[model samples]
Target: MFIRFLKENRYVSLLLTFLRLYLGWQWLHAGWGKISDGTFDASGFLNGAVKNMSGEHPSVQPWWGYFLKEVALPYVDLFNVLVPWGEFFVGLGLILGVFTSFSILMGLTMNFAYMFSGTTSTNPQMVLIGIFILIAGVNAGKIGLDHWFIPFFRRMLFKNTEKEFPQNI
Candidate 1:
C-alpha cells in the first residue's frame, strides 16, 4: 500500500515540490534582501503606507484604515519588527521544508492580510499562491530537510500515539 501510494503520486509530488521550491526560493530571496538592507526601515515604510492609505490618491485604502490608525498604530513599531522577521523565518522554513504546516499557515495569513488591504492586484496572485501551498501539502516533497526531521519531530511529539503514526510505520 505504501509503495503503491508513492508510485502513483510520484509525478504529482514532483510537480508540487517544484512549485514549493520555486515559491520558497522567491520568498526567501525577497525577505533576505529586505533583512540585509539595514537602511530599509520597515517601521517607516509601514507608517508611511498607513498614512497614505488615508490619503485621497492612496494605492490601497480599505475601510480598515480607521481601525488601523486607531488600534494598529499603537503597536505598529512592534509589528514592523516582527513582520519582517516572520517573513524571513517563514520563507526559510518553507524553503527548508521545516515546520512546513506552520510556514504555510503563516504565508496564508500574510497573503490574506495583504489581499484585504484594498490592494486587489497583489491579492489575486498571493491568494493563488496560498491556495497552491495549501492544496499541494508540498511539505512532503523530495530533497527537503523535512524528510529527515519530520520523523524525529513526530516521534518526539506523538510518542504515545500509535494510530497517528504513518501507516507504513
Candidate 2:
C-alpha cells in the first residue's frame, strides 16, 4: 500500500518532480563550476582517493583501489572530461525528467563514488533522495519527458498491440 501510493499517486508524483528538480539543480551547479573554470583538474581528487585506498578503515576497497591507481591515475585526462560533463548531463536529464530512471541511477553511482572517495559532504542525503526517486519510478518522471518518450521508446522497441508499456517493470 505504501509503495503503491508512492508510485501511483498524482500528489506524490508532483512532489517527486520537485525533488528531481532540486537534485538536478545541485548537480548542474557543481558540474557547471568545473566546466566554466576551464582549468578544473580531477587529479587532486583522484590522488586523494588513492592515498586512502588501503587500511583497516580505508575509504576505497583494496582491489578497486589498485584499479584506480594503475588505470585511472594513468589516464586522468579522461576523468577530467568525464566527471564534469557526466555531472552536467546527469543533471540535465534529471531536471528535464528525460530518461529519469537512468539519470537517477547515474546520480546514485556518482554519490557512491564520492562517498567511497571520502567526500562525505552531502552525498548521503543525495543518495537517500536518489533512492526515493528511483523507487518512485515512472511516477517520479510522469510530469516530464518520460511521460512522452518512454511510450515512444516502448512503441519503437516492443511493438506491443495489447498495451502501451508495463510501468511496473
- Best candidate according to TM-score: 2
Residue 88 of candidate 1: its Cα lDDT? 86
TM-score of the candidate numbered 2? Answer: 0.92
Which runs of model 1 end up more than 4 angstroms from their true locations?
A: 1-8, 42-63, 120-123, 138-142, 161-169
Model 2 lDDT tens row, 44-107: 8888888887778987877767777898889999989999998999899999999999999999
Question: Would you list the clashing residue pairs of candidate 1?
Answer: none
TM-score of each prediction: 0.72, 0.92
Lowest-sum lDDT 10-residue window in model 2 = 160-169
Residue-level lDDT of model 1, residues 17-129, one tens digit each, is 66566667766776677678854454454455466575567755656565556656787766666666777887788778776657767877876665545445554665576
Q: Could you tell me the lDDT of residue 141 within candidate 1? A: 41
Task: Determine the C-alpha RMSD for candidate 2 after optimal superposition of all C-alphas.
Answer: 1.8
